[model samples]
Target: MFDLPPWQSWEMFGACFYAVRINALLVLGLSTVTLGELLPGTMMSVKTRSISVELLPSRVFRCTDTFGASSPQRISRQGNPLETIDWTSGDWIAVNDDNGVGVDIFFTLKEAATDNVVVFVDQRKRQFGKFQPCHAKDYIDKLSVCPDFLVARGARFVGGIMDCVSPSNLEKFVVPDDCFILSQAGTELFTALWRIIQRVRLSSPSTRHAKPPSRQCFKAVRKKWIKSLGKL
Candidate 1:
């Protein structure tokens, strides 16, 4: 089977549960408020590029298994990829791999000299994939090809980010609404994280996560469907 690009393939939405500690720190003012929360009045004008990639069924399964599940009362077992992506790309100005190891994929715009952006996805080996509603439209004006689909033999949604020059005199450019920020904590966080980590660690490249509260297992040759933003 041919897998299209994940960006054009599915609309998967799941918050990274790992941000609980980071959120706690931010809430307590331990860390600098993410660039997204900077005072809007002092913001600057800088072109920003954001990419939202939906991991194929394989990648999503690995991630949820690594973090566990989401819960309100307890610290969420899930880790928020949004926050991680924002921190690596937005704050650090570099895409990061949050697999707790090293970054996997890296990308850069033609304008920038030094490639600072890095990207990662959580998934397993497959034929190919695709993505719809690509973010490339924001930057590119004239396009020879519309990124309605993405193709790859195997998809991996490990964590990563993109980096670029910090716009001067542009604090506004420094912050974005998309920055990862959410409040969650407690025993729930521990359970979720532990379970997820275990899931990813134990996952054989052939498995998938389809269970509930956070399914973390799947068959190698299966295609999963997720809700699209516009359709939902």
Candidate 2:
């Protein structure tokens, strides 16, 4: 006779617990790949009676078991996680000029084994104001504009804004030419928005220049935007 723990016994009763409901029905049948001989603790505890099961390529999915087996968890949210890509998307867009000199930003969910959602900014033309993906080098070669130079210029814009607005040095805020090289497409864009927020704070006489709350509604929103860029 196999004796089960309290939690196991309760879970085995039915799908009464939230974990049971989430894992068993959602993930479906799981197969054990490892073959382990019954050890001392194997039958002693329900948790020990488990074998490691891999759910294909590690896309995090929630798992539940009657015997309280460990399982991967899936994210359930209101909308598609990829759509919230503001910081990186905006950053790539900002680097490109309005005249279509640089790359155009676009993103789509690549439904591969692990759901490789990629955000890319490529320089290409499309019909009806659409963006098409092309090689970064192709865009640079066709436009006769050095990609390195563009990156440098964008970095300069970001550093200059930060220096100008920073409380420590407003006067000696020289925008570095190589700032863009140091800054990636996403980081530069995020910095730009942060500067904008600071600018708005400075301009408004009534509003005190207090640091943005670390844990607040706006910060939470910023986090979601950051997640799109895969920056956490």
Candidate 3:
């Protein structure tokens, strides 16, 4: 049986850089073309007897098992285990922002696979609009639904504040292997950060005349957004 992606998640963006890179390289090195046997693992579901976890092109959906137990062996009323979610669906995920607060939230699948759902959570503090990490002892309200999204069996009902998308936009949907969908807050946070970076690009002496920083720089920041990842 092939290995399914781990259930765990990264607590920081810096940590994910190397994680994604290493996984991507491993995925690249696999050379499925030369090793045809790997295809079956890619084609089959690990949930039914087993699953395969591909790190390369490390998109969430590509790395996770779409087929899972309709009814999990165990589910806690106050906790969630929807780890290794599908990035293709723009699912919310956990990440430690530069602010030292953990940003985690996402929407879940609705009734069926085709009829999926989109949700956005208010992870910020009710009074201040600051992020409220589930790890913090003070975030009692969010602690109950600690880890927000649930990849439930049968996809009966999803929980969270649903996001609305126009019908015209629905027709143009594709899950690129390079990008992962994030929660609304996450999307906003990333957008804000990118805007800041853009401003820096326009004003910074080193980048003013030069092209935007190299891709490696972004990857470098991800590896060490909080600290550093040793390998390239």
TM-score of each model, in listed order: 0.17, 0.18, 0.20
Which is superior by lDDT, 1 or 2? 2
Q: Which prediction has more favorable lDDT, 2 or 3? A: 3
Q: How well is each residue in 91-164 modelled by candidate 1, as lDDT tens digits?
A: 11121223322222121111122222222222211112211112212112111121112112121122212111
Candidate 2 CA-lDDT value = 0.23
Among residues 3 or more apart in sequence or in different chains, the pairs in candidate 3 whose N, CA or C atoms overlap within 3 Å are 14-222, 46-50, 46-51, 90-181, 224-227
List, residue by residue over 1-232, the lDDT tens digit for candidate 3: 0231222222223224323433333322321111111111111122311211222222111122111222122222112335333432422222221232222332231222244332212122222332222212233222213222333422222112111111112122332221122223333333343343345335544334543335664564344323322211
For candidate 2, the per-residue lDDT at 120 reads: 22
Model 1 is weakest, by summed lDDT over 10 consecutive residues, at: 68-77
Among the numbered candidates, top TM-score falls to 3
Clashes of 1: 67
lDDT of 1 at 28: 26
TM-score of 2: 0.18
> Could you report the Cα RMSD, in angstroms, for every candidate shown?
20.4, 26.5, 20.5
What's the best-to-worst order under TM-score?
A: 3, 2, 1
Alpha carbon lDDT of each predicted model: 0.22, 0.23, 0.26
The candidate with the higher lDDT, 1 or 3, is: 3
